[model samples]
Target: MSAETASTRLAEIHSRIARAAQIADRRPDDVTLIAVSKTHDAESIQPLIDAGQRVFGENRVQEAAAKWPALKAATPDIRLHLVGQLQSNKAADAVALFDAIHSVDRLSLVAALAKAMAESGKRPDCFIQVNIGDEPQKGGVAVRELPALLAEARAAGLPIVGLMAVPPVGVDPAPYFALLAKLGREVGLTELSIGMSDDFEVAVTIGATHVRVGTALFGARA
Candidate 1:
């Protein structure tokens, strides 16, 4: 996409977000828009960056490490987030590369992240991913196990900031979204990493502090 195309896409999504936030009686600025650049390379992502997008999400630690260093060096404030399942093996690399991590789902990952943080002295914000719909294929911890994971994460100094979830597809996501919000509140977490290109507006209305938007911003993947 051209710079203009990227800027236009950003504006359209922001407008939708602002409208949704207004309906929720919340400020649009409160909801951080993370342009998910999972498969897109620097050349493809540069237009969005040139259009003033500072925050992006990537799926893999290695891909982000390869793509973001130069981009971040040029724009010191660009924040990268890990929005995909995190492997314990990549904990150290993820800690060093991402400004925030949204896939912290298990005790092992929490321990890995804590050890990485201690070794590198870098504490990236973390959101516990909840398998809110009880989907066995998803990357989050089951809802019944959230408390244990939260306790362990907090105990390990993992900067447990909020909850992240991807509701089951092809369903009325409002209930799932509301449930995620309630779960976050129950755990005393104020932030929420819910929503994506399709259901993000519904998510914003339900109090999503962060929305990971890819197709809406970068167009469909090949």
Candidate 2:
């Protein structure tokens, strides 16, 4: 997309976010918009960056490692987030590359991340992923196991900012978003990494601190 198109698309999403925040009586600035750039190459992403999008999300550490170093070197203030299911082996690289990680789902990964952070001294914010719908294929700590995992994550010195979740596909996501919010409060967390291109408005009203929007900003991915 051209810079003008990117700017217009970004403005529309921001307007939607502001409207949603207003309904919830919350400040729109509190909601970070992570333009998910997964699978999009640097050439495709630069237009959005030119349009003043400073925060972007990517799914794989290798993809981010390939593209973002050059991007960030040019635009030092750009923030990159890893919004994908991460492997324990990639913890160190993820720690080195991402400003935040939104998929802390298991004890082993938590351990890996803690060790990586301690070794590297880069404490990127972490959001514990909750399998809100109990989907067998999803990568989130089960609801019943959340407290223990969260407590362990704290003990391991991971900077636990909040919780993240994706409701089952094709379902009303309000209840799931609200449940994630309640769970976060119960754990004394304030940040939430819920919502995406589809339901971010509802997620905002339900108290999402970060929204990962892709297609809305970049157009349908090829």
Candidate 3:
């Protein structure tokens, strides 16, 4: 998309977010819009950057490492967030590249992240991913295991910021969002990283602090 198109899209999404926040009695600034740039390359992402979008989310640490360094060098204010399942083996790279990790679901990953943070001296903000739908195929920690995981993360010195979840598809998401918000509060976490392209507005209404918007911001990926 052209720079103008990107800027227009961003403005539109921001307007929607602002309206949603207003309706929810929350400041628009309280909810961050992370343009998920996973499959998109740096060339395609630059227009969004030019449009003043500084926070982007990526799925893979390797892809982010390959794409962000030069983009970040040119635009020093950009923040990269890892919004996909994280492998224990990639912890070091993820720590070095991402400003926040939203898929910390297992104890092994937490331990790896802790060690990586210690070795690299870079502590990325963490979000405990809960498999809210209890989907066997997903990567988030089960609700039953959240307390222990939260304690483990804190004890390991990871900066546990909040919770993240992807509700089941083709269903009303308000309840899931509400559940995440409730879980976040119960765990003493304020940042609820719940929401995506389709449900982000609902997420904001239900108290999402971060929304990972992709297709809406950057048209359907090829």
Candidate 4:
């Protein structure tokens, strides 16, 4: 897409977000729009950045590691987030690149992240991913198990910052989002990563600090 076209599209997307936020009875600024630019080439995002987007989300560490360095080398201030399931084996690279990791679910990953932090002399903010839906295949801890996980993460000085979740495939997400907020507050977590293209408005209304928007902003992935 041409720069002009991308610029126009970005404007439209932002306007839609503003309208959605308004309709949801929230300030537009209260929701941070994280353009999920995974599977998208750097050229596709350059225009969005030109259109004033600074934060982007990537699902895998390798993909992000590849794209972020070049993007940062060019833009110098773009913030990258690892917003998908992260494995412990990739913890070191994740620690090196992402400004935040939004999917810290397992105790092993937490321990790996802490060790990586100690090794690198750097610590990135983390969110506890909760399996609010309780799906066996899901990549988060069960909701009832959150407090112990948070306690362990905190004890390790892991900079446990907030909570993140994906509601079950066929459930209303509002209650889950609210539950995350309540649990987050109980643990002094100030950040909540929820919502996507379809339900971001509900997320904003329920106090989501970050919404991972992929197709809504960038169009569907091939």
The local distance difference test score of each candidate is 0.95, 0.96, 0.95, 0.86
Question: Which portions of model 4 miss their true places by more than 4 Å?
Answer: 23-25
Q: Quote the RMSD, in angstroms, for model 4.
A: 1.6
User: Which window of 10 residues has the lowest lDDT sum in candidate 2?
Assistant: 1-10
Encode model 3's per-residue lDDT on 1-222: one tens digit a residue: 899999999999999999999999999999999999998999999999999999999999888899899999999999999999999999999998889999999999999999999999998899999999999999899999999999999999999999999999999999989998889888899999989999899999999999999999999988
Model 1 pairs in collision: none
List TM-scores for all candidates, in order: 0.99, 0.99, 0.99, 0.93
lDDT of 1 by residue, 1-222 (tens): 998999999999999999999999999999999999998999999999999899999998988999899999998999999999999999999999999999999888899999999999999999999999998889999998999999999999989899999999999999999999998889999999999999999999999999999999988999
From the highest lDDT down, the ranking of the candidates is 2, 3, 1, 4
**Predicted structure 2: lDDT:** 0.96
**Model 4: residue 154 alpha-carbon error in angstroms:** 0.6
C-alpha root-mean-square deviation, each candidate = 0.6, 0.6, 0.6, 1.6
Candidate 2 lDDT, tens digit per residue, 97-121?
A: 9999999999999999999999999
Clashing pairs in 4: none
Error of 1 at 90 (Å): 0.5
Q: Tens digit of lDDT per residue, candidate 4, span 37-102?
A: 999988888888887889899999998887779888888788888899998999999999988899
